[model samples]
Target chain A: MTSGDESRPVTEEELHAHADGLLPDGRRAAVEQYLAAHPEEAARVEGWMRITASLHDTFDEVLDEPVPARLSGLRPPSRLWPRLAAAAALLLAGLAGWWLRGALPGGDAYREAMLPHRAAVAHAVYSPEVRHPVEVGSDQEAHLVAWLSKRLGTTLRVPRLGPLGYDLLGGRLLPGDRGPVAQFMYADPAGKRLTLYVARAESGETGTAFRFSQEGAVGVFYWVDRSMGYALSAELPRAELLRVADAVYAQIEKVPG
Target chain B: MSDRDRIVELIPRLRRYARALSGGRGEADDLVQDTLARAFDKLHLWRPERDLRVWLFSVMHNLHVDQGRARRARPEVPMGGEALLAPASGGPGDVLERQRLIRALEWLPAPQKQVLLLVALEQLSYDEVARALGIPVGTVMSRLSRARATLRALLAGDGRAPTLEVVR
Candidate 1:
């Protein structure tokens, strides 16, 4: 609502704000002048004011009414549930100590194992989309790559998959455990989409070995290369996905490494 | 601090709000008890980053909506329990008008009544009302305007909903 110029009349929004005492003094004065010139609108505004005043008068006393004992005595009974759950977990761990040791992946092994599953989950969430498949489209691939590289603090590249019968569909930035992850999407001739999720390696460690993991229908091929960890996730069978993963690996490895 | 203590502090204000919404002290106390129980059970869903008051109001509003739906399904259930009794110390005329005001408030659509009460009674800012109701600021402005208009018309007794018989 305009309150700047005399020519810019006060609008309905301004009037409502004034009625509610939400407008600044300057704007409130402008609205008052407008209402003065308009008697019917002024009358309506006065009615609204009266309504608020009456409402306040009618119910303000409830605030001072002695709160019922039932309400004051109410407390969440589940406050200790978290502590109990934690205790149970510790007990289970202690009971199965010998069997669990070396059986469960922890530390670096846990990170290496979970990375692909995260990529697969991201794929499951974004794939099969009719619209908004990527935050930035492939037409602005150069800008997308530069923006992501800047955010992740790394020189990132979008690998071309033209020979693999999939076209680059651009990328989006996503939250990762350690830092930001840059995910690039590609669509095949059949319209099936795959994603390449890249993020900084934990502790700057590098692992060139390509490992596979799957969740539901999605399969992921992830590896840590130099300062970055990369995961290529798709819903295709393992054999078909392996071929695409190899191509992606080769293309990414050749980026001035 | 635990959610229990945080919620306990808000009980007075919550009771006040329930009193206004339910239109009777007994019903309002019942509503408040239900709301507190629901809030406690759903405490895990609350995020520390969000405003606790607004979240509690949202839970209470949802519970009220569910109760309204169930009430509507059973129209045979008699409505209007004990009339919202304002003390007669304000004089007979003032008492009747106050009773009329409370009755008019109950007759207003739940959405408008909510916006009006949050702003007029609770003095919540437009943004806070929007967050509590999960509506946009623009909607808040419009709904509030409509609510106040309906309230004014009803109080003026311009022939809308049936007038509740004021008990002596």
Candidate 2:
């Protein structure tokens, strides 16, 4: 038996297993007997242990380095508001909270570069739900818009995509790398999803070139307005998604305050 | 913790493992991104009693295996490409010892190198490694032993593992 108490002649596997501290009590004792008798084999097994220790030293730093936002699909729900407050304070002081941005180069470059990808990741993560998809369903559209607007510190509008074959499916409050963000979900007649990602743009941020990034399976059309960034993401073709984004941008632009 | 929280916590270890398998940071992160996508897509397959960490590791492992099969029949990416050459942490000190150890690892057959890392770096038991890789525990032990022997030979300048290309 693999865990037998009988000190059957130890195999080489048992010796290394001894080095790994992986042997069971019975086999561990037997291997201890073998290693006690054979000094050379004991020394080699010790080397394995040392190698294993140094491997941790070499790689564990990755654990502390911030995970990139591109990989973070959603920040935990409880962490949203506090980070939003901190992000707003940093924004007022003309600093964009570089500490929260991870190792993605410097300043607004991280946001400018990562916005679309983050949106696409969020879309891929949440847009597929048959249940519990939105925190506030469309039945409560006024409350949803007001709550999200309060959290995001801006006026909000849900674009009417009726002409474009998609209808409002409500929205959720999410934690962005820098602050609280909002996602407005829409669905076509066949239940295909499109999400609009909204976050506060840094002060002094200029209007963008209207970038389109294909993040894995999702296509994202994203841009910066005067004080907000927007990314409309979906599995739709580029032209189709662009048309929808243009309509959304136009409606959002109509919000006066 | 929520499954989402646990998943977020495990990203770094997944990246470190990806770095071992595929060397470039871009490639490693891409691998991790892909892994996260797959894990979320297959989240329904996971049982509540199973180890999420191990299950996620297997998701990454199987995803790579499937992607590997698609790209020209290669067993895996060419090892020792670039991640190992960079210092694993802090400033690049002597790094000679670390380099030697990594070089030895790069020389190992992909299977052995994988088993070795799963054991040494991730601290997985043979049984867990077997479960993650879909192999028997006996096979995990044999590959690990072979990996040890090969590492011993390469580190001693014997150049024994045919799979490793000696950079010197």
Candidate 3:
């Protein structure tokens, strides 16, 4: 071996190799000899050794403590689309009941009857432009698509909404009752914003449905398609909101087969 | 208990590995929990013949990588510098040392860190680590060498010899 090899001192790689139990017998012996001569290095290595021991001590107890009941309990195997359909059915029934009670007029009547206005309340609480606005951005559209597709097991096209004077801002992958959902954002020229949250249904069925409500001045619209759901919300006028909904539907419909 | 239950039992071990890899940040717990939840949700995909702990580790590893990629794609928002440097509380000097070990761990490159953790902390064989990381055994060996050398340098302070006692 060259002098360079001899004086090189046991490298971090070799120490890691030694730590990992990967060094060959001969090299390991050499390293041991080097360490014998080098007290400071020995202490450092010993520190890491202690660190491993400490980690086991600190967290290993979690194993013996009973696993959380919710985690351990048997959960009924759920079909993705069917559960989604059941939820939608319950929601529609609730909406129909409310509509009958009020006897309101037109699609606006149905819109007012069933939308999740609380989501708008949540949106306003979390949506100021700054850090942590959305988990994923439009620049990584490819990754977002792949991830959401894998989770939902369906090809999700990022709907184009240029005609509504809105451009794709970004999207986030969120957990839902069925699986993961993709939430896409669009912004108009004046900086007004809207979000399209999409997820696969637990069942396969198609129908035109609408739910609407007002929360702190924000109008919310939600709908369901065959094996999918969409929610749209903003502070825009009801008519303008419907126009945006139409644009969202048209673009989503054009998602390539 | 079924295979899924057995897999669930391995969560704590997976969490320990994740904590070592992540410098004992609570983020590691989240990583392990997410892995377990995903594995449970997709239990059908797991093959029965494989080791459950190894499979869980693989899931944790992938989730860590995906999260890392997502973090990198976003603009870096600076957290306070002191928060980055403060040692994790709890335990004794040993705990502090462990935190140091993990911080030193962050100094190594990602590939070396992965190889070192799998082999050293998890005590996987070189072959097992290679399979877990989808790298060759030789690459695992070399990477471990580099990782240990770097750790020794960092810990021992500037190219000093390392004191290692062979376990008889």
Instruction: Highest TM-score: give the candidate number.
Output: 2
Name the lDDT value of residue A213 in candidate 3. 60
Give per-residue CA lDDT, model 1, range A1-257, as digits (tens). 44355446777767777777787666666677788889999988887777677666777777777776456645543234543443355334433542454445455555565577667766766654434679999999889989999999989988889998999988899998887888899998767789999988878677669888755567788898987888998879998889998998888889896
True contacts kept of each: 0.64, 0.42, 0.23
> Which ranges in model 2 have alpha carbons more than 4 Å from their true place?
A1-6, A74-257, B69-94, B158-168
lDDT tens digits, residue span A26-89, model 3:
5776788777999977776776565455445544555565544333422222223433444455
lDDT of 2 by residue, B5-93 (tens): 78888898998887766655787788888888777667779987888878987888887778772232232324543343333443323
Candidate 2 lDDT by residue in tens digits, A1-257: 24446548889878877877788776766777778899988877876776677667666666777887657643343133433443344343222333454534554555566677667766766776544568999999999999998998878878899898998899999898779999999988777899999988766775775789776567899888867899999989999989998998888778785
Question: How many Å off is the CA of B115 in candidate 3?
Answer: 2.1
lDDT of 2: 0.73
DockQ class, candidate 2? acceptable
Q: Mark the regions of model 1 whose C-alpha exceeds 4 Å error after superposition.
A: A1-7, A76-257, B1-3, B69-93, B158-168
- Model 3 segments more than 4 A misplaced: A1-257, B24-26, B69-93, B158-168
* lDDT (Cα, tens digit) per residue for candidate 3, span B1-168: 877658756765676677666654466666766776677667787787766666777777778787883133321212332244344565544556555555556655667777767776677878778777777888987876666666655544443432222000
Score residue A120 of candidate 3 by CA lDDT. Answer: 55
Residue clash pairs of candidate 1: none
RMSD of 3: 15.1
- Candidate of highest DockQ: 1
Clash tally for model 2:
0
